[model samples]
Target: MKILFVNTHYFLPQSRGGMANTLDQLCRGLADRGHTPGVLCAFLGSRDMFGLATRARIKVAAMATGIGAAHDAALSYPVWRAWHPVDVLPALAGREQPDIIVAMGGKVVQVIDAARQTGIPLLTQVHDVEFDWHGGDFAHIADVPVVANSQFTADAYRTAFGVDAQVIYPFMPLDQYRTDTHRRVVTFVNPLLRKGFRLGVEIAALCPELPFHFVGAIPDVDETGRELDRGMLALPNLTVEPFRGDMRDVYAQTRVLLAPSQWNEAYGRVINEAQVSGIPVLASTRGGIPEAAQDGGILLPADAPAERWATALRRMWNDETLYADLCAKAVHSASRPQLQAETQLDQHECALEAAINDHRAAHLSGCQLPA
Candidate 1:
């Protein structure tokens, strides 16, 4: 099937975040499976919308009007700016008629007009609570199936939009995260001290004997990243490194992955990545994190004192056999191979197939909204 997978902008659909990486992997996987998958994104900031990566899987094009700033708050009036998938219609003229169009978020608005014009089915991948938070008007933008990356997101859609959404957890390329053995380091990625570390530092301070390493920066958001750095400057046990995509080696040196996120995470990629890398996790029970943790590690309750985290860490360190057991479970939970693709070609094959199927069957037979 010929598929057109669109993002509001090019930043996503890259290796940076789970949402974009999921699409990138899926699109490439679909292409390998013999489907023609093309990408339509906006030319934003300094990115090459028509860069080689986007060019390789399918035909890539950038529209003059781009969507919201990549990490902006929520769906606001000018958040998307003039971004709309409608403009890409001219570039897509006479292109192989797409059987499906799969989009992740408000970016779906960009392609709704084109899908209506062509009668192609549309499928939306909801990665967060935005659709539900914004209400039903957003539902009209797509006449296709909606798939959320986690139950949290799916439930939000049902409650907010009165539309039932299917659960399709985002796929990670596990091969990149595969590890040989569990290590002794305790690690955190994209460490923002303000978000959760007031407690994390207290925990680390309580257990001065253990090693705590913070990896990754604020990512697309510069101010938050800098603020996190400023907060961490005084701490000696907490070593902060700029963001690095592949943390398998880092995980190899660490026995536990700590996610003390204070946000309402729809689902966290770090939890999965750390698990795949064979690191037991110790995290705060916030948002969809418990879902991501599954039964893999210890979940500290929201209001649990930082000293509780310290106690858990000390227990894991002393009980070698218990820590080993947790490591084994983490590997098992994250080792699902059907999701990961080694080569770019294999990644697109799987992504395109799912995107195409979603486009075709996502909506009710007559294209009516749920009653």
Candidate 2:
């Protein structure tokens, strides 16, 4: 089926975060399976394109859909509505004539209206706790189906909105993330406060001998590589790197993966991404880390002190036996049957087909689906 996926966040080649990478894999996987999948995103947004860096991002969005679909924020809106994305998704949908619309984030209400206006099947994807800013407003879009990134995310929405979302882990092409070189750096995928950046920094500082790599996942890294430029880190052991479209570049040098998440993550895709390369993860127990880490890695409290993280890092660095065990477990966990790329793609196809059929049935009966 021809499916049009909508996400407000940056798609691949814009942001190399785990979500973006996996979504790219998802689209590519679908395309490989004889399905045409396109994506619509805010793409550096409609407002504040004045900076040279912002304009560069706009240019980089050339392959917006990554599947040869037209993508551009609507430009007809007044200046006051600049904060909002250019709202032309419905018109785009009308022209693309997709059998299904799977909207991810940003102004999802707009996506809902687009689906309703275009009379297309809509499936909203919940990637995390903050899937929608207007979470309570889900009652309005009760008829729509949901595809969650993990069971934790699905359960959260289920408890809050009485929505039974189908859980489909994001697809990660493990082979793409594998690397030959394993550097000594302990890597953190995205270094932000919410992602436990403070803890990661503290741990690095505490362990003077251990080197840490902080990979920025932001679109432009605020143009000047914000994390590295600050010069705030007294310890020279930590290196802040800019976002990379190809994570193998980062993983190639990464010995251990760190996810000191302060916020409750929906599903830590990066752990599995790193694990596929036989890299063990040391993460927090805030949300889906346990689920994602499974038997592969170590988990500390989100509020664990810097000393605890440093100790863990030191042990992982010094103890070959423990490290080897965790590394083997990481590989085994990543190689699980359900975690395979083909499996993920199959799940996505099945979910989309089911959602599409449900919408068609509802429309044929001339009835709004029961919540």
Candidate 3:
């Protein structure tokens, strides 16, 4: 089957976030299965970042809109209506002639009319809870099916828009992450407040004896317009590392992974990555962290004090038997049937096929779709 991904943002070979990474993996998986896959995205100069080898694997059709950084805001319905990809979509779709159209992220509704006009089955992939602001207006479009990344997100959609979405966990290439390297340091990625940066700093400050690595670029200022905390930097044991595309290097040196997110995370991909590496995670019980962690890691309340985080870190570092037991559980949990790439891909394929059949039936029966 030929599938076309209508992405609002650039879908690069090595994307930073879960949504982009999942799309890249899905496209590659489809291509490997002898199916043709292409992407229609907003031009964001991401193509220049792709190396010669990565650019050759997938075909991309980027819409050229002269508006610079405003393109990112185009996911908003008002912004999208004024600067939508409607003009370019038909032409691109005509050339690719995809069997099914998968619109990713909150900008799915932007290409709904074009997909409808082309008479192609459209499936919206919802990644987060803020879809109401993104593309919730046309979510009730009868022929379009929605696929949520997790049960938490699926429930949110059901409650907010009465959309019973199919839950398909995001795909992570487990084979590539599997390793025999010994773990050593505790690690944290993307040190933003919502991701528990402050808490991580406190944990690092309290456990000054153990080495802690904070990966990813740090923002100059936080949400409150205050200078970013430099306390973590002051600690002799803490090392700040830049964002890395390939996480194997990060996991290689990580004894425990910290995901102390304060906000309700839709899905914590890092938790899965760490678990697959046989590294136990110490994360807050925010949204899907429990689900992501499964039985692989320890979870504290989202509002857990700095002392609690510090105590957990100290125990993991000092208690060799406990650490080994958690490591064994982490490996076992990651090896669960649901976490497999094949299972995820199979569910995705089934959802797409069912969407095509359902859309065709609705069209043939002349059923009036709900607005």
Candidate 4:
């Protein structure tokens, strides 16, 4: 089967985090299984383009999907709208005529509409609750079948829309972490401008004796990082290192992963990455963290006050047996078929096949839109 995967965020090779990595991994996995997959994303930055000025400009301009106003704004207008109908995806679709289009989040709603215009079916992967902003407007284009990253996200989709979705947890490769363990500090990996980072910083400051390293580029880090550096350094116990270079090194030296997210965390990949590193995680109960943890690590209430988080950190630090148990549980959870590629790809294929077949039946009965 040929599938065109649309990502509204950065899909470049070096792009960081879940959305980009998931597209890269899933596309590769599908290719290995004899399915052809193509990716489309709006370019945000440019580099090494002295001889490719026009191409760089086109790439940069195609990335503007919508205006941002809300605190959690990835769900605004589909970011790829600038390049949609006639941009990269249409060119690829005209050439490949993909069997289906799978959109990861609300940012790709325009991609879905354009594909539907070409009489191709769409499969939206609801990564977070759409009601957050993009969900409601995008719901008008809800003719496509859907997939959710977790039961939490899936339930949120059903609560907003009347339809339920097939649940597919994001899969991660664990073999890379097998022989790497250089423990010393706590680690948090995500965009530093987010609430996840703020909460993480607070937790790290609360436990000053243990170093807290954040690994990820922050847009406002130069100005904000300088300010944060000063404040964190003043504690004499906290270290705010801008996430630079390979992340494996960061995970290697980290004993524990901390995600004290207060808002806008659809699912904490840091929690899962920590599990792969054989480290225990102490994360807030938000979005899909609890669903993702699955008895793997410690789960605190989403609204647990800062005082309680500090107390929990102290308790977790002191209890070796509990820490060991959580680490073991994390590994056990990671070992499951759901988190691995081969197994996850199989689940994806089975669900896609079933959904496609069911959709065909509906089309034949004049229930679904004609392709």
Candidate 5:
């Protein structure tokens, strides 16, 4: 089946963000399974949207690869952005002839337009429950197939809108995260306040001897990045680094993955990614984190004080036996059969197939899909 993904996020289809990485892996993974997958996105990315050098790089890639030269490049590996995707979706779908369209990025408006314009089957992955019916996004999604990234997110939807969403853990290849580099730095990925930057700062403040590296999801070179990063910079023990396309370099130095998310994360991809390297995670028991962290995680209450977080950090830093056990558990947690990319990809495939068939039936008969 040909699957075209519609992700409107500025960082997506190229993977400068975590969700984009998930979608990119999903596309390539589908191709490996003898199905074609493609991405359709917006051009106005936050940065480097039309930087001459960036545009040159994209143009060169298009020239070099042309189309279908590589595996499922049959979709031409489209690097496009639409101001109004609803206007462009039909023409693109007509050319791509995608068997179905999946929307993983946080845009239901476009997917709804797609159903009306092209009659293509629609499947949405609830990357986060960050938005709501009042957000003007969920109000129209009563019939769309929802695949939540975690059980907690599915449960939230069930409680809020009575929608029974399917759960498909984000697809990640555990073997790829194994790093031979020395692991020593205490690491935190994406230090936004909602992601609990303040809590991370407090922990860093309490543990002055431990080195904490805050990994940014985007380039923190901008004024906004600098301004938001002031708290972590105030501490001598902490260091902030901006996002680069590849994360293995950051993972290379990470002795412990610190994820103190203040908000309900739909899924904490970093927790799982860290475990793949046998690195223990000190994360908040919030949202889907526990699902990803399992026994490998040294979980704490999201509302835990800075003292508690610092104490845990100190323990992880000083207790060799505990650390070693967590390391083994981390590896085991990551290696679990259910967390494998192929495993989740298979589930995603089944979900997509069912969604397509179900959409066909619903549109033809005007009946609601069974819960």
Candidate 6:
């Protein structure tokens, strides 16, 4: 099948977030399966996220509208700024005549018109809950199947918009993460408040004997233009690091992964990444994190006190037997058949084919597509 993915954000390879990684893997998976995959996105900046050229398997159609970083930052909804450029999607679709269209990054509003115009089977992949941007409004688009990254996100859509979504967990490249080497440092990525940076600092302070690595700075800055939280920097045991796309190197030296997110994450990709690397995670029970962690590691309440996290960290580090058991479980969880990349790709292919068939049937029956 010829699949075209329409994204609001620049799907650059250097991008460190979960959405970019998932899309990259999906495109690669489709191409590896002998299907044609293409990406259509607006150019956010000169540099791509991966700091590398686009892969040969995936064809890219980037719309350059001369809207630079300053303009993007000023907009309340930066993604909507790409709507003007994305207007070309219909023309592109007409020429390519893709078998299926996947609208990602809550850009459904921008793509809905083009998708309807093309009369192609459209599937909206919801990555997060952006209430302010009306991300869930994609459910109202006729004949467009909504695919949620997790049951937690699917339930949110059902509850908020009365829209049912097919749950397809994001795929991760487990092979790249398989490593036997493990260091003693605990690693945490994207140290923003939403990601439980405060909790991480508290844990670091409590376990002064053990080293803690804090990776990635908060994207936003305060009125004074300071991004790093002073409290976090003050911790003697904590070592701050820059954000990177691939974390295999970091995981290679990480004994434990911390994903103490306070926000309701759609699906914490870090948990799966850590598990695949045989590093147990101590994630909060926020959104789909518990589901992501599964039986690999411990899940504390979202509002769990610092003391609770500290205690858990201490036990996991001090108790060799418990640590080994969790490590074994992590590997087992990641190696599960259901979590395999092939399994996810197969599910996605089936869903795409079904959507196409459903669309064709509806067209033949002279029936109006579902709202």
lDDT of each: 0.62, 0.74, 0.74, 0.65, 0.75, 0.74
Give the better candidate number (1 or 4) by TM-score.
Answer: 4
Error of 3 at 153 (Å): 1.3
Error of 1 at 37 (Å): 2.3
lDDT of 6: 0.74
The model with the greater TM-score, 1 or 6, is: 6
Number of backbone collisions per candidate = 17, 0, 0, 2, 2, 6
**Model 4, poorest ten-residue lDDT window?**
68-77
Candidate 6, run of 10 with poorest lDDT: 69-78
Per-candidate TM-scores read 0.73, 0.84, 0.84, 0.81, 0.84, 0.84
Candidate 2 positional error at 72, Å: 8.1
The digit string of per-residue lDDT tens for model 4 on 27-76 reads 76777788876665654433545214424445455454222111111321
Best by lDDT: 5
> What would you estimate as the lDDT of candidate 3?
0.74
TM-score of 1: 0.73
Model 1 residue 307 distance off true place after TM-score fit, in angstroms: 2.2
Clashes of 4: 2
- For residues 1-371, what per-residue lDDT tens digits would candidate 1 score against the true structure? 77666666444323255565666656655655666666555534334543343333222123322222122212111111113444654345235466766665444654555556765666666777644432246567634567777788788778867766766667666677777654666787766543465566677778778878777654333344433435533466767676565567687777778888776778877788888766778887777788888777888885788888889988777788888888788877776553345443443344446656655565446487768
> What would the per-residue lDDT of candidate 3 be over residues 1-371, giving only the tens digit for each residue?
88877777644433366676777778777677777766666443334533332232222213243322121221211111112444566655665578998887746666676677787778888787765545547554634688888899888878877888998888887887776646778899887777888788888888878899999866677888888766547888889988676878889899999999998888888888888878999999988778788877789998989998899888887899998899889988788787798888888889988988987888779976689
Indicate the residue-level lDDT of 1 in model 2: 88
Quickly count the clashes in candidate 5. 2
